[model samples]
Target: MRGIAIRIHREFQLMDCASALSIEGLVLEMVGAATRRRAQGLSVRPSRWIREVKDFLDEHFKEQINLSTLAKCADRHPAYLSQVFRRCYGSTIGDYVRQLRLDYASKKITHSTESIADIATAAGFYDQSHFAHAFKIHTGVTPAEFRAATRKK
Candidate 1:
């Protein structure tokens, strides 16, 4: 991880009013150190496949994203890609993409005054209905209901 990434994460934790030196924070620090040590000062790591997949997802989240295109992007067999992705992220690619889109939508919904339809489209769901289904499935409430509740807060 970049030093800036670590710093920003620590700053965010502090801003959240959590302990800067909590057990979880300490464990994350140690894990990061161990990872750096294991790299053994190697530059240009062997992350071609995963990096390719991540880039593809980042650039193409708004379309009809599919596993076949991702497998092709990584230049790996579909099964291998699926297995490797699960090992790295503890979730299927579909679930990972959905989570990412929902996270993006949530940030927009909270931070901006965009209409729900616009937010849904911006978050990569092709249509409002699909976005509604996904939002409700993940958050246990429709987007309208979520916005309403947040207003109450």
Candidate 2:
């Protein structure tokens, strides 16, 4: 992981953030490498298929996700996909998606002036109330309160 970070820093110095494709490629490689290492270092070895499912979820978390759809994409049965995903990642797919949305919304809430409704929409929530409820459950604070706390740093 440290080596990947150093390589990424070197790549950035050579070009800049303007080369978003290069940066993204580097990041993907780093994540893949790290995942492989984690699987090897852990008690259980994760399937390569689970890694593919994880990458897909990471890329499409903002979109509506259906287990049957994901199963088709992964070429696995929906029940099997859910089983492997939980074993490999230690969370259900739905919970992972919810966490991803909340994390993204938290970043935007702290750094951007967007309204809570707009952030909720962008984070793939159907409505602000739902987003707020999920966010508060995950973080133990409402979005507005979290933002204010972050801004004080």
Clashes in model 2: which pairs? none
Model 1 C-alpha lDDT per residue in residues 1-153, reported as the tens digit of each score:
233233344344334345454436656865776576456543334366776786777677766788887788678899999877765544577877877787678667767889999999989888889999988876556888767655554
Best by TM-score: 2
Task: Give me the runs in candidate 2 sitting further than 4 Å from their true place.
Answer: 1-43
lDDT tens readout by residue for model 2, 1-153: 443454455345445455477668779987886687577553376788888888888888889989999999889999999987876665688988887787678779978999999999999998999999988776556888877766766
Off by over 4 Å in 1: 1-48
lDDT of each: 0.69, 0.77
Pick out the ten consecutive residues of candidate 2 with the lowest summed lDDT. Answer: 1-10
List the lowest-lDDT window of 10 residues for candidate 1: 1-10
Instruction: Please give the lDDT score at residue 110 for candidate 1.
Output: 62
TM of each candidate vs. truth: 0.64, 0.71
For model 1, what is the alpha-carbon lDDT of residue 23? 36
lDDT of residue 87 for candidate 1: 56
